[model samples]
Target chain A: MLLEINDIHVHYGKIAALKGISLEVDEGEIVTLIGANGAGKTTTLKTISGLRPLSAGRITFDGKDISRLAGHKRVLAGIGQSPEGRGIFPGMSVADNLHMGAYARKGDLSKELAEVYELFPRLAERKGQAGGTMSGGEQQMLAIGRALMAKPKVLLLDEPSMGLAPMLVQQIFSIIEKINERGTTVLLVEQNAQQALQIAHRAYVIETGRIVKSAAAVDLLDDPEVRAAYLGGDLGEPESIAADEPAATADGPAKD
Target chain B: MKTNESTRERTNGSPTVTNGRPSFAALTPRARDLAGRLPAALRAPGLPLAFPFAVLGLVADLFRDWWGRQTGYVRWAIYGLLIVGALLLPSEQVGGFMSPYSDWAQLLFFPIGGYILLAIGLNVVVGQAGLLDLGYVAFFAIGGYTMAVFGTKFGWSFWEILVLGVLLSALSGVILGAPTLRLRGDYLAIVTLGFGEIIRIAARNTDYIGGPNGISGIPHPPTLSEWTVPESEPFTTLGLAGIAPLKYGALDGRPYYYLMLAAIVVTIIFVKRLESSRVGRAWASIREDEDAAELMGVPTFKFKLAAFAIGAAIGGAAGVIYGSQATSIIPRNYEFIISATILAAVVLGGSGNLPGVMLGAFLVAWIPERIRGLQEYRILVFGGVLVLLMIFRPEGLLPSRRRKAELAEGTGGMGSLGAEVGGPTTHAAAEVGK
Candidate 1:
């Protein structure tokens, strides 16, 4: 396993955001965690990133415990997260924001910047523009590109498809697949479970503060129980499955 | 529970589960690292920056004064022109002509010079770093009192006491910053205000520094003993053509003016260089967005402490100058009003701009003293003008380009070309357009 979260618990004051839940991500895999709002998807990501402290249990990355590491140190240790809300430094230029991403690294950043530009051509065109001014899909692309600039071993993407049109969503998913193919591991959190699972190697369905189901992407896609409960209905019929697949890729449908 | 429910309802249309599985498998590990490249020497261009110019200007001014004494021609010419102008003008206008030349030396020397130094220090904390210190006066008081207590009680030389004063003020700054930095924004302001009041009250109540009566009998700075000429004759009385007596006291205002001028120049250079360096950029980034700065790998606490310490040290230097010039120091002298006056200069001058702060300091200090005929009414007028200025031109007379851009972007108004380059559209796109 590249990363192991051993039954970690986190809290906001008296309220527990993450209960004792454990999971693992091996190298060279796309793992998706799907849940409804406030099911602690963002909290789980935040804890792994060290933005939030774990109240109990441990988080180990690459055989080293990092439960007490600061957020920036975790970044240096190769744990990068594009936070929920695409927390781009709005005051900075698009190029400057990307520069900030590579802040922990020491070397010529132009090569990295050029690589990010190659990944997102729109970002390249708007390099001099402020990060705050870009379109939603473009900003999302920039955010991912920025995280990529850090050259992390694994990328933590929190709702990358959020607020993006279905076309942009497909584009983002393809980019994620391309990124994964390029030798970086990926841990994805999403509301668009059907699509997320479509690309993910393995997946976990979370409810409240615990994992309800864990399976391979294709198995989960076909699972009647998962469809009925969280995937928006039965995927048993070929016609319904085809319809669901198109809906997942259609423009603006998956935005909500 | 009710608030949480309401917040949940407002956010996603339902009260969803607050806790869920802790999934490390789902944790993405793409690190948003700050690419530590070469220092920003390339990013921020221009040689020597603002500080060197200020130093050069000080040096040139000092050289001009020294040159004026050697030939006596410039001094005589200045007096001749003044007299000529006075004679040429009507009696009422003669006063106006003389006014510019009248007290020009003092105007250039004391309050303006002192206030500029104070404002620059305050600017470091409140403007460049966004710490919003209201009790910055406490540092000033500490600096002044350090000089007063040591200089008067121990009969320490003025220059030595000045050094001590700076060190003590810096120490005081660190002590204050260490505890108060945990508080943010308005809370920090209130805490600092209380701290300033505490310092003032303590000074007033303390007996070692003479309490309410304060310290007196402070001596002037010592003369350079190496340069020997004749005895019991004024230095000014000596002609440049022949070697004459060296009377140290006669050199008085000229030397003091030049010394203070040199101090201001040094401070300006230090601050300007600091602003453009790695440290300066870090401070600016923190000022703009602290959490972002911290996430970007800046040690926020250390930088903030440094800002406070540097500011306090400058204030201490000013205190030394103030003490030596007055030959006395009192608790009343370092009062709340002095703090307010310094703040007013900083605000009115355009917070981070050195020249603007100097101009502000000059206006605040000199205007009141100049209008001493108005006495108590001067303060009322000052307050009224401040209010009017705030209402009419809140950016002060000369705001920094970044500040102007910020204001323009914030208010959704057109500013200069640079401001218009990145306006409210960017902000809107970031927050709501998504």
Candidate 2:
């Protein structure tokens, strides 16, 4: 395992946001956690990113405990995140926003710039524009581009498809897949279970901060209970088919 | 070919599309790149060059004085040449046209110049870093009082007291920032305001610090042996190597003028360099949005404290200069009004704009002195003018383009509703949303 979270608990004042959540991500795998609104999906990501301190248990990445490390130091140690709301530096230029992700690095950012531009060509054309002026989808692209500039070993993406049009949503997922294929492991948190599971190698289903199920992407798509409660389906309906496969599989045709 | 054609089209009149929206490319690519790179490059290297250039300029002036002493006719000719230069130059540059070592100019420029330095230092915290620091004047007062006590009561030299004052002010800044920085906006402002008042009250009440009467007879800075002129009998214009004997007095305006001028130059360079580094960017980020900055891995609390300490240290340096040059310091001299005045200077000049701040300081400090007849009405007129300026030119006299854009965008919907009313309305709405 590249990262291990052993029963961590997190609290926000009197409210417990995460209660004994445990999961693992093996090296070079796309792992995702899918849940509904207020299911503590964001809380889980925040805990891993060190934005919120854990109350109990330990988080170890690459054989070392990082429960005590600050968020920036964790970023420097190769865990980079594009936060849920697309936290681009709104006041800064698109190019300057990208530069900020590489703030921990020393000298020569041309290579990083090139890599980011290759991934998102629209970003190159709008490099001089302020990040605030971008459309929601474009801003999402900028946020992802910024996180990639940090040269992380593992990228943490939170709701990359949120507030995006269906076409842009498809594009973002494909880019996430491309990013994973380029050798960086990914941990994604999403409410869009259908799209997230399509690209993920393995996924965990969480409810109210507790992980209720964990399985391979195909298996989770086939699970009736998961499809019924969390995947927005009735009990007797065929399980939502994984969209990647051809028509007429054992699971039936994919839903539009 | 298409890329080059598009580049040329952009250079022409084709509206540049930014983030799938229209934004006119006001500055060309080369100009934009230069603007980005120049400040970052010059910021670090500029300070080390300042002291050397100042020393060299002083040496050159001394040589010019010696050359003028060669003959009575030569002295008269130099004066005539300076007069003609003043007549030909613009009114603004006429200050430069005068003799570099003029006593009258020194007296007029010194205190206000010191205030300008203090404003820039304060700007680093309140303006660039977006920390509301009404107790900024406390740092200035601490510096002044430190210099007065050390230089006058203890008989310490000016240079030693300067270092002591800076250290003391920095300590005070850290103390103030540690407790109040956790508070945001108005709460922070109120805390700092109370802190400033407390410092002033303490200065007035403390008998060890001369109580309400304050300290006096602070000694002039000790001259370096190499630069010091010998205290000899008056000689004719025709002396050794045809150089006239230099005049010396307790308040010889020439030496103080050069010293203050050097101090201003040093402060400018220091502020410019500081605002360009990684530290500067961090401060800017904090200023724009604190919560966002915090999430981006900035240790916001620590950086805010650093801003306060650094600003206080600079203010302390200015205070030392003010006390030594004036030869007295009093609690009455360091009041809330003084803090307001310094803030007014920063705002009028354009916060985060270095040269603009300096110009603002000069205007605010000297204009009233220039028209002493209106001294009684100074506060009324100054306040009225500031209000008018804020109304007409909200971004200041020389506002940075980025700051202007921010203000424009931040207040895009509330056009001409008056900032005083609109500012609170929008801020309340934002808070409610949060």
Candidate 3:
């Protein structure tokens, strides 16, 4: 296993956000955690990134425990996250935002920068433009490209397709597929179960702070339960999560 | 490769394409055609008019690099000229015209130079790091008290006390920030405000450092031996010719003014260096989005603390200089008004830009003195001017390019003096996600 989360537990005061969640990603595989609103999907990613402290259990990357490591040190240990909400620096130029991604590394980043621009040519065209001014699809590309700039062994993507249009969604998923093809293992947390399952090798279904189901992506895609609960049934339209959960998806129900 | 083709295909209708290249849509049709005809290198991304300016900037950058490389002698010569110009500002020929009321030299040394120093330090916290510090004068107070106590009670040299004051202020900064930095935006400001008041109250209540009366008769910086310069014709001429008196005395504030100038120079050098290094980049990231910066591998908390400590150290340094010059200090001397005044300087001058803050400090210090006879109406006029400045030029007198863009977009809500507003973070995703 290249990355392993062993029975990690996270709590937001009295509420348990991630209760004994365990998963693993082998080298060069796209492993996804798929769930509905308020289903601990974002929480698992946050724990791994060290943004939220885990109450119990450990995260090991390449046979080394990184549970105690700081978030930035976790990046140094080759865990890069393109966070939810496309966290591009608003005041910074597109080029500067990409540069910030590789801040921890020393020396020249010309090659890395060129590769990112190549992966997302839209970013190259908008190099002088501030990150905040870009369109949604472009901002998503910038976020993903920025994560790649870190040159991580594993990339953690949180809702890369969340706010994009259907056409842009396809483009982002295809890019993610290409990224994994280039030998970076991916741990994806996504609400779009249908698309996430299509690209992932394996998938884990999370609900209310626990891993409810885990299986090969192809098998889970065919699973009737997942199809009904998360995939929005045979209609094939992505469910209106707001109608389903009523604000529970906004940072989960962790805040009092 | 196929993925790239599909992405290009989907986004094709968006970016205006001219001659199979992305063309600037915002440009006029004629300008757009002209831009297309220009060399590819000159045609910048979205900004067509920036092509010539970009070329000019590149040439200037190249020239600067060459100048820096060809000779340290030329660099020193330029700096020497600037230093001489600055040194001459307090002289009769310069100071007389600059201000007609009180001594311009004395004003420069204290309120002008001092406000600049404080503003620069606060800019590190409020501007770069996006941490609003309302009670920055607490650090200033700590510095002043450190100097006064050491100078009076322990009889320490000004040099020794200066170092101690800076260190203690830095320590206090860490003490305040370690617990409070977890609080963001206005919450942090409130905590810092409380900390500032706490320091003042503590000082006022304590008798050892001279409570309300404060400390007086603080010793001046020691002079070198009388024979360091001969008491002869040429030496006397040099002394009369505005060579700063080595012997710091009671009446002539010139020597003290020179000392403050030296301190400001040192502060500027250090600040300029830190503003471009890794530390500065980290601060920018934190200011933009704390959570994102942390996730991107910046130790956000540590960097914020560092900003506070460094800012406090500079504030402390300014305080020590102020203490020595005044020869006495009291709790009243270090008040919330001082903090607010320095903040006004930073905001008026342009927060993130170093030269902007200095200019702001100068204006803030000099404006009242310029209208010296109308002292009673100073507050009203000052308020009116600041209000006017805000309405006419919200990004400040010399905003950094980043700040200008942010204000232009009106995304950060920083253009207004809304007390609780945080720096701009991308709300597009949130809005769409919702």
lDDT of 2 by residue, B332-379 (tens): 988998777887787777776665676677667766555545758966
Identify the runs in model 3 with alpha carbons over 4 angstroms from their true place.
A234-256, B1-81, B93-98, B224-244, B406-434
Q: What is candidate 1's lDDT per residue for B168-255, written digit by digit as tens? A: 9999999999998866666777788888899988988999878888788666666655353344434223311122212224323434
lDDT of 3 by residue, B185-212 (tens): 7678889989999999999999888888
The local distance difference test score of model 1 is 0.68
The lDDT of each candidate is 0.68, 0.70, 0.79
Residue-wise lDDT of candidate 1 within A1-256, one digit each (tens)? 9989999897766667678878889899999998766566777887887766788999999989999988778888888777676756554568877887777677888887887888888888877655544567987987788888788888999899989999999999999999999889999999898889999999987765677778897899888766755578855776566645523442232243
Which is superior by TM-score, 2 or 3?
3
- Give the range where candidate 1 chain B is weakest over 10 consecutive residues by summed lDDT: B29-38
Among the numbered candidates, top DockQ falls to 3
What is the C-alpha DockQ of each candidate? 0.13, 0.15, 0.36
What's the DockQ of model 2? 0.15
Fnat for each predicted structure, in order: 0.11, 0.08, 0.49
Over 4 Å off, model 1: A33-39, A132-141, A158-173, A189-199, A202-256, B1-110, B224-257, B336-348, B353-397, B404-434
Better model by DockQ, 1 or 2?
A: 2
Which candidate do you rate higher for lDDT, 1 or 3? 3
CA-only RMSD, every prediction = 15.6, 12.6, 8.7
- Indicate the worst ten consecutive residues by lDDT in candidate 2 chain B: B236-245
CA displacement after TM-score superposition, residue B354 of candidate 1 (Å): 4.0
Order by TM-score, highest first: 3, 2, 1
Top model by lDDT, which number? 3
